[model samples]
Target: MSDPMNVLAPEHRRLRIGDAWRDAASGATFAVEDPATGKTIAEVADADVVDGLAALDAASTAMAEWAATPPRKRSELLTATYRALTERSEEVARLITLEMGKPLAEARGEVAYGAEFFRWFAEEAVRVEGRYSIAPSGGYRILTVPKPVGPCVFVTPWNFPLAMGARKIAPALAAGCTTITKPAGQTPLTMLFLARIMEEVGVPPGVVNVVTTKRSGEVVSALLADGRTRKLSFTGSTEVGRVLLRQAADNVLRTSMELGGNAALIVCADADLDVALDGAMVAKMRNIGESCIAANRIYVEEPVREEFSARFAERMGALSMGHGLDDGVNVGALIDEASVTKIDELVADAVDRGARVLVGGERPDGPGHFYPPTVLVDVPDDARMLKAEIFGPVAPIISFTSDDEVMAKANDTEHGLAGYVFTRDLQRALRFAEGLDTGMLGINRGLISDPSAPFGGVKQSGIGKEGSHEGILEYLDLTYVAIDLPGPARCSGRPACAPAPPGRPTLPTPSRSRR
Candidate 1:
């Protein structure tokens, strides 16, 4: 079979603004490389400050019409988009592997998972409702309604490129807001392909605009500085999130951040060892550990720590590493050489601080940015790997005696995106599940993210939720309306107006029409 990457050809490689494909005003472009081979696969038009401003202007112009669209009509469009995405799943998955290194199977799974958000939010669009209440004085009624917040800016990351973009864009559009998305430079091709899909699915020109650029700082700054963009949603490192937050403060923009995480996988003594091992492999190594919610720290109860560590090391050692397109390959390359250097540095520091490397640790002898799946034991708390988010294929194990001790260690970090606990005891599971400070917890499960559940973190991890019904609310504004009733009986400060008999008074039914 021919390579899917080579077989597919994208219709447009330039900025998508309004109704057409156009080049950057400055005529700049950037090369997107395949992480597995370090080869420039394609050159994408790099939007400049002028193009960024134009996208924002277009979105702002479209906001009024989109917001006025009926909820059911919005649902119909999203449903059509969901079907379109599902039909082209294979092509999009291949594009993901070509642009960002992840196993082809995993990339395929991401496409299906990403499409689910569109389907889920399509159903959610029509269900968005408000509340009505009778005033205390009985002369008026109060109606609370949800309105689109207005134009939004989505800044997505490279990891899980298709899914992350879909997760943010689908909800924003469903909420009746226009948006301009700025995808990471490393993997903008898949997102650009998605923009084409949106256009093909009958999405209006300015309702969805995608801008790819190497000058991310300049573009992001231009969008944030514009007062018309009412909201900004970002998914990336906490450091960059902070910078975006400062820029967003200029307009007091509404922001939703899905930032960094250092999640802990706790394996109690009573856990099913075999099941625990499977969970560990999936949690720590999925996406080559590039995910923010990937298991970064492992705390095993003392009784099973050694046994678990040995089996884990053996499993890690046996896994195959190669290009994502290759059959039977279990791991892929890091995002770039800088990521490779950071992983190596962290492992070296841990080993120097009395940590023991049980399996692979060094960079592989190869042409691409590949690193062997590494396992470490006795990693000290002071080691950088334990202190920071390790976005690589490295698993560090720590042994603890009791649940109290492990819980303390797990909640020690500033991040609280997601965590995992493995145990057969129901009471103990509930105890830790409630005690953990993270936003989402997995009990005996490695995978916690889904379109039906709310995905976000507390504290410094992030500000708001995504993927659930609440996620749509983040893009909406609540407005209250009061209506005064007319008649001599409804008039205030009139002695002739007496309270109605309490037995059975007919109240007017509220209208269901969209205002």
Candidate 2:
């Protein structure tokens, strides 16, 4: 077997522009640390605005030819890439665990989830369809063709590094759009290594480019300003997403923002406690609770709050924490010390606001950025964590007496991402399913993401979807074509007709769009 540490090989740590691998024009580089140990694992080229623009130019130059490639050929390329990614799942999964700090088992799941995008989009490539319809106006035929949106920019996040990049890149490639991806600086290796896989799988030069840099604001701003760039897809905090939106607005660029969320998990009175506890663990602790869809504010009906809280807290307290690469470790470190500080402050504020910590709430004393699983009860509404994403393995349970009150409080926030409800009552579940102001609802299940599902939120949470058929739509635009039929044949105008002359309008030949 190949060494797992091979991910840090010199050849794997560089910027990929067109068909070449090299350093930034300024010879700048940055350190990539293993979140589990807070130790430097690799130094990768830190792309500046110079590198970003060069990558964009390469994508623009390769756009038309790639867009013109037959859909079947594109589909074949994506399939090959998917097979290659799956074949090397262990190596890629290790990089994810080392860089992003999810448990090795969880990282393996992410590897499979990431590769699934390429496989799913491969089938979708041949399924990009247009429609033929009769126009309302007589003598005219109407048709619509979907075309590549042109060069695109994808700014991905640290959590779920592999899947996040795959979610954006696979669909963009399947839709025939050339792209330049800037993975988050914290976890750039996964994308960098994926770039190598793309080249090995014979993806044409410049069709897909990868760049990483600490100067994100400057680099991203340049890409958003490029006249040739047609779309922007970003996955990150709402504060940064807003900045990107303003920058993209200046160019009137199409954008897909999968921003932040403060999702609520509701446990109704009729809920099965066993089922609720199981779902709560998965919903609240997955990726150490660093998910946009992770339940941040868990509301329980007054009748079952105590029972639910006790069982849930026991589960949280029992989770084993250690380095991600260690066997049987259920939770891993936060992305960095900053994340540790934020989680600490939130727990402190809640404790100050009359909330009681039932179990672990303190940060562990260690070299890693680790926080123990904590459960806080009697959490007041005024607590700050309720309004923003906790992004940690801390659960705050608030008891409520009525459904209407709970619904109003749940929807009060600007975010409308994912919500969870554990109810055995059909009527009640259906009511909350339609009532909750989130894009996705988990009526019984906890893990909501699926390869074929349309994954995204509404309102401030996000602007567009990222999975299923909608995933491909973000990189495509539709153009309408109309044909006006000729009037009845009239050859009674003497030589004036002259076969309608070369300049005149005659029988129209069917001209099919290359798309």
Candidate 3:
């Protein structure tokens, strides 16, 4: 028989009800596995429709009370949660590694970045504001303010479990909205650990409930149907993001979606080849290239294509691929076996269409879902790898003679989430920065996803921004309240407010708004 479930942690913690954790009514359990070793790490409760409904009901019951609490209190609660998370960083990191197979170092980074969301949004809690204006000829005073968007459904993906989960949860809580989180079934341990931490941080139970289940569609449908879930936050593939958007639309719920990306790395003729190669290696190989912002395509100037490809291949070959927890293991297995198959099909199709496989292009014969780091040249624009979001460690490099041509090619795909350009020419770099059809760009660097910077995409990438002040506002509703000082008539829809009084200490008609 296979190894017994090694979940040392409890499988079913009390669902956060009112002020306490309570058992699920369904009493169903499912096992979470370590993808590296094909072993079960934990058996978590499988949240069915019943469990999901209960969570929603709990949040619904607690929404008014939580919303009434002062913003300072909300910020303080998130502050406590962040402190708890930092203090238990090691423990949570271990859980992430155990369940998701991300490296210990990267896992630690996820925890730190996850906590940053809490800290940043904690500070943003008080920034929610309303503007004051004078109504034109209404003679009435209006008061408008920003308020919590009520209950939200947070569905996070398997990759970057803790960070993605924290991205959704911290903001909703900071906005004084109760939430129900659904972590990917394959990796729920880290999220469960976080839920426990939130409880300890004095978050009122039922303020946040996490459920792990294979029946995600059913649970999601139930939450969407319930009028109480006013907003939905999701981070995953574009296809799934679309489905969620449609479902959310059925109930007219607000949404924040961080979807898939087909990011391109354009290496100019004068770029620092050494720096570009090093950064591309990390960008293409980090998280085994499972990241949405990872470099998927490389468009090098014809003058330097040969040298850059050769040097890039050498470095890629030097990478050590093994288990995530293994020391010096730079590349780890993909999240699942099916993803391995998909990567294989894409690479094979590209090769069949005359693309040259420079470094890697196949999955090694192994027990785990491991695909070799792949690099391709002469990749046709029609190749699936070029147009589709290959969520794996495959870089398809195509040569371009002109900057304009490559820019067109890079923006050819429907995805406009993230892109990269490496160049020593300041003028060219500025032009590319202004022209690249993407929401975020990296110049001479591969770093994206900064907590202080807003992250989201345009076109098919999804709607609304996440991160910075824009991210926090996703959980809030803005209302403009116009207050007309107890006075006479003002301008009536004219460019200049009703002609200012005739030199009798006449005041401007409050043309612009004041906070």
The top-ranked prediction according to lDDT is: 2
Which stretches in model 3 have alpha-carbon errors above 4 Å? Answer: 1-8, 11-23, 135-142, 482-484, 488-515
lDDT of each: 0.91, 0.92, 0.83
TM-scores for all candidates: the values are 0.93, 0.93, 0.90
Q: Which ranges in model 2 have alpha carbons more than 4 Å from their true place?
A: 1-3, 486-515
124 Cα displacement, candidate 2 (Å): 0.5
- Model with the higher TM-score, candidate 1 or 3: 1
lDDT of 3 by residue, 435-507 (tens): 8889999999877777778999988887888778888889888776666567775557775756556775765
- Runs in model 1 deviating more than 4 A are 1-11, 136-138, 485-515
Ranking by lDDT: 2, 1, 3
TM-score of 3: 0.90
- Checking candidate 1 for backbone clashes, the offending pairs are none
Tens digits of per-residue lDDT for model 2, 277-359: 98989999988999999999999999999989998998898899998988899999999999999999999999999999999
Backbone clash total for model 1 is 0
